[model samples]
Target: MILIALLALPALGALLAFLPGRTGRLAATCVAALTFGLSLRLYSTGPGFWYEFDRAWVPALKLRFHLGVDGISWPLIVLTTLLTLLCCLYSLWKTPDNRLIGLLLALQVGLLGVFVALDLVLFFVAFEVVLLPMYAIIAGWGGPKRRHAARKFVLYTLFGSMLLLIGVVLVVNQTGTADLAKPAGTATLAAFVFLALGFAVKAPLWPLHSWLPDAHSEAPTVGSVLLAGVLLKLGTYGLIRVAIPVAPTGAHKAAPVLAGLAVGAILIGGLICLAQTELKRLIAYSSVGHMGFVLLGIATMTATGLQAALIGNLAHGLITGLLFFLVGALKDRTHTGELAELGGLRESSPQLAGLLGFAALASLGLPGLAGFWGEAFAVIAAAQRGWWVAAALAAVGGAIAAAYLLRLLRKVTHGPSTLKLTGPAGYELAAWAPLVVGTVAVGLAPLLVTGVTGPAVDALVEAFTK
Candidate 1:
């Protein structure tokens, strides 16, 4: 029941928020908070274990209305719940229309479903559910190029979803079961490729990533947070949870290719970031580099590597979420992200400047921040596998990380506070503080994430090595 509540509450909230006036934003925010509480309560009742509810939906096909969360799922689940709560709160000051709030809640419900769903069909359905509202948000409310961005986003993602569906079909057909917990067969290379392409598009790996920057730049603040902070993880998560586990031999066969592409994305994304002026676009490219570390982790197929991937996901969410929020604020006041025209933000808004500095430093892989361990440890783990070349490439990625982030910070935070404003408002400060606190807390205490993820990685190592 708690599990159901975790999935259903947002949906109910979305439905009710359709009611006329009467604090629709407040109602939606309360629902998100309540949902987060429910998730915590569920986690507490369990002794660091998966809470699953499975019952036959079709005995003829072995599919079920299955849902569960292990250590791997829990971190992402916590991520989903936490980010959703933040999104709701953040929506308070910039509250759009009540319909928008309801729509955002709908997106949250679907994203939650995607993270915990166990059945392949359930996963796919949940995954697709996130598309419409997001597309609507982008197309309906985005910037000058919103329609194009939304179209690109929808087309690319749907194309990837098709590939993913093909992969699911092959796997289910081969294994006679869609349950994620069961051991996958070793004989499904073709199916694996189908799945990888689909997931990669979301991972937005290299060639498939064209849509992301445009989407992020155009979408509203809450949309960008969830998109960066959660939506993209859907790809990498599916890779680890479904693709690799279902076809180990195929995964091993593709490891080299995946590793190469991961390295390429890092370098290329870094170069692109250096050239980009649009605030959102720069952050979008950084995502390309960040997820490369995740792909490298998966490519190494080692326990430590996998841990790096999981932790990296958390770090990217925190760092990028903050980046988007700040970008949105800047856009609100100055009405432009063109670096050539914008200058001296620190003077204009010391609070935004200070927070941006911390997030930027954290993003550059400063030791104390959440961003450090995932890439650093991923390279270390990769070296142990004699994949030192890839490790070196990852090091280059880090250097590029420094290049782009420093460039962004210099422009956004330095100079002479180009756009002036009254200092941070109460609600604005309230909204911004959680993300700032999150970055610092995770940076200082990396284990809040790594501890939860380590066991899951160990399980993977044991499975693969055996």
Candidate 2:
């Protein structure tokens, strides 16, 4: 029931926000705040428990209100709550519309529900629920090309979701239960292929990532923040939550091809990032590379591999979220995201320069930060599994990461500082600083997240090992 409450607040708020006179923002913000409080309550209440609620809503079909949370998902839920609260507070002063807050809240509801819903039908519904509000947010409030971006985003996502639905139905009919805890080898390989394609599109792995740069480049600051910070995780999270556990034999069988695709995303995304001229689009491409690393971790089909993938997912969320926020701030101030059009910013806004530096370093996996462990673990896991070639390729990917990020930093924050722009405004700092500090803190004390997640990981591994 608590899980359901947490999931419904934002949706309810969205519906209510259409009223007159500041009602939407006020109500939505309060609802977001309450949702965050509820998320925290789940943690202080118990670190390693799943608060569950279920009642048959459709006895004829065996579907129910089934919802739950565990250590594996709890941190993500907390992270979701914290980021949403930050997004809300950040938007207080300058967020565009009363309805915008409602949309933000709606995105949060969909996101939190994605992490918690246990039934396949329920999960897919929540997963697709995210699409509309997001599409509306981008097209309604984003850059000049908002319509183009939104159309591309929706069309691609719809196609993927349809394929995902097909995969889920095929699996459910064969396996007899949507509970991912149940093993999933009964489905034909065709179903697994559809499922993998559905997810890979969202992960935007390699060739399927074409829509991302447009969405990121065109989205509003808050939209970009949520898109990168939380939304991108949905596909990967689905794979982890549903694909792997539910179809272990299939997942294992598909590991090599998946790993190959991951490596391709890494090298290709890295090369493309090296060539990007728009700051937001560049960040989007880097996500392609970063997600590639996460997939590589998952492909190892080992305990360490799964752990690396999980950590990578969380760290990528934090780092990319911060980066998108900074990009938005820059865009707001300079009225541009084209790299060549802008010169150095360090002299102009020392604060902006410094924050970008920190975020870039973290994104590149600077040691002792949130980004380091996931990449490091991936390399180690790959090597340990005798995927020495893939490990070497990942190392090369890291080097490529360094090249693009360092070059980007040099272009934007170093060399000239000639933009003469003002420093990060109070509100922008308010939104960005926490991300920087949190990224660093998580980097230094990775165990804070890893510790909470370990037991759950052990349980997941038991399926394959035991």
Candidate 3:
């Protein structure tokens, strides 16, 4: 029932949002809040599947409506609900459109469903469920080039989806069952290749990442928040939950190439950010780099590497989510996101400047921050695999991250007041405060995440090794 409510509440809310007037908006917000509260009931102490619901869905195909939650997926589930709730809250003031709210709730259902799905067919259905709603959000409510950006997002992901569909069909044909709980049973390397390539596009790994910057730049504030915060996680999560486990030999064979491309994304993404003129574009590019680290961790195929990747996923979601929110606020106030035109933010809005600085520093993997552990451990995991060169270059990517993020701060926060701006509004603060508190809390005690993920990651590593 808890699992069902986690999806059903938002689904019902999405339907409610289509109704007229403030009543729809209020109901949606309340639904979001309730979903978050319901998500809390998912918590448990063990390193096993905490809650599961399974039923026959397609007898002919051997597909099931299977859902399960474990340490590995629980945090992401909570994060998805929390961010959706916050996005809904922000919409009350910023967007105020019933349709947009409906879209967000619909997106939440997809994201949560993706995390809990235990059958490959079920997972694919949830995975694809995320597409159109997000496309609509970006196209309907985004900036000047919303149409173009939305089109690109859909095209790229749809291409990935084609590959993913092929992979899913191949897996089911070979294994004779879609149950992820069972061994993949003689699935071939080609199946894994299709899956990896498909997920890579969504992960926007390096060469595949071009769609993201435009989408983020054009998406409205709440859209950007969810895009950075949780939508991207679907790819990385799919990699861990689906691709690697189902095709361990393929993953092992592909690790070197995967690691190489991930390093490229890290360095190349950082370099691009350094040259970016627009704030949102810079942040969007930064995701390519940040997710690079997570992919690197996964590529290592070590228990430590996998754990690092999980934490990296959560950290990026929190820190980058906050960055987008701040950037959106700046654009809303100054009527510009161009770095050159936006100066002396500190002079006009010291509080906002300070929060921006904090988010920037945290994003750059400052020691004692949430971002540090995953990056640091990823490097250590690479070294553990004796990939000294990869580790060294990845460290260089970290340095580049620091350089670009600090540059962003100097350009926006330190200059003499370019335009007078007010501090974040009450609702804006309400939306942002939890993220701020979460960043600090997670940074201070990574165990809040690591403790839960450790056993599950260890189990996953054991499976692939066998």
Candidate 4:
């Protein structure tokens, strides 16, 4: 029931967000804050699921309204709620637009649903629910090219959704159950391939990732934050939770192919980032490289590798979300994200420049920062898994990341003052402080995340190896 409340509160807020005008925004903010409090309470309970809900939803088809959380999903649940609160805070500082707040709350509901859902049918439905609100966010609130980007996003995701539905139907039909615990091994090769392909679209792996840069470039700040933050995790999470565990043999067979694509993304994305002149687009490209490391981690199929993947997911969320927020803040002042037109930010807005530097350092995987553990662990996991070539290539990715990020710093934060940008606003600090703290905290103590995800990873690895 508490789990239901955790999922329902934001949805209810989305409905209540229609209250008059400004009241709607206030209502949404309060609801998000309450949800954040609930998430913290959940975290305090510590490292496992507390609530259980299972009852028949579609009796004829053997579906159930099942929902729960485990250590595997706990961090993501908290992260989702926290990001929603921050988005709301940022919205409150801006004009309290009714539609924006409403959409945000609705999106929060969809994200929470993904983390808690235990039935395949329910997961698919929850997954589809997220698509519309995000489409609206990008299309309605985005930049001049938003419509095209939004359409591209919709088309790509919709196609993936179709494949996902096919995979789900196949799994349920074959196993006669929608429960995630049941082995989806009957038609393992076909089912796993379909599921992995579907998710890879959302994961935006290598060749399938063309839509991401456009979407990020066009989306508004909060849209990009949640998109890069939690939404991207959905696909990778599915691979971990559903695709691999259910079809271990198939996953093993596909590992080499996945590893190849992961390496491609890392190298290609890094190279593209080097040539990019637009700030948001470069950040968007960097995600490809970052997610590449995550993919490499998963492809390794070892306990250490899985742990690295989970940590990388969480780290990417924090680091990229911060980067988007900082870039958005600068864009708000300068009206452009073009690198050539922006320089000497430290001269006029030292605080913003400093934050940007911090974000860049974390993004480049600077040791003693949040980003370090994931990439470092990824390389270590690859080496331990005996893919020496992958280990070498991944190391190269790290060097490229450093190169591109340092270039960004020298071009935008140092040098002669080019644009007179204002420092960050109060709302910006309020939103940024948590991400900053998370970055440093995770950097200093990787165990905060590893501790929670370890048991789950061990169990999965045990199951897979069997």
Candidate 3 per-residue lDDT, tens place, 398-447, comes to: 99999999999999988688587889999999999999998998899999
**For candidate 1, lDDT tens digit of each residue in 1-466?**
6788898899988987777785777888789889888777655322224688888877887779888877787778877877877877777667647777787888888888887888888899999999998898788768888899999999999999999988888988888778776655554889889989999998888868888988998888878888999999999999888888888889889998998898888889888999998887888889999998889888888888888899899888888888888788878888888887777877887877787788788888999888898899889988998988889988988998998889888887777764775566677667667777877787788778767667766776677666
TM-score of each: 0.96, 0.96, 0.99, 0.98
- State the lDDT at 351 in candidate 3: 91
**Of 3 and 4, the candidate ranking higher by TM-score:** 3
TM-score quality measure for candidate 3: 0.99
The CA lDDT of each predicted structure is 0.83, 0.83, 0.91, 0.88
RMSD (CA, angstroms), candidate 2: 1.8
In candidate 1, what residue range of length 10 has the lowest lDDT sum? 41-50
Candidate 4 lDDT score at position 9: 93
Residue pairs in candidate 1 whose N, alpha carbon or C atoms collide under 3 angstroms: 344-416, 344-417, 369-443, 370-443
Off by over 4 Å in 2: 44-49, 181-185
In model 3, how large is the Cα lDDT of residue 30? 95
Candidate 2 lDDT trough over 10 residues, lowest sum: 41-50
Considering every candidate listed, which one attains the maximal lDDT?
Answer: 3
Candidate 4 residue-wise lDDT, 371-466, digit = tens: 998888888988997889988998899999999999999989888996777778889899999999999999999999998888778877887787
The better candidate by lDDT, 2 or 3, is: 3
Best by TM-score: 3
Those runs of model 3 whose alpha carbons end farther than 4 Å from true positions after fitting are: none
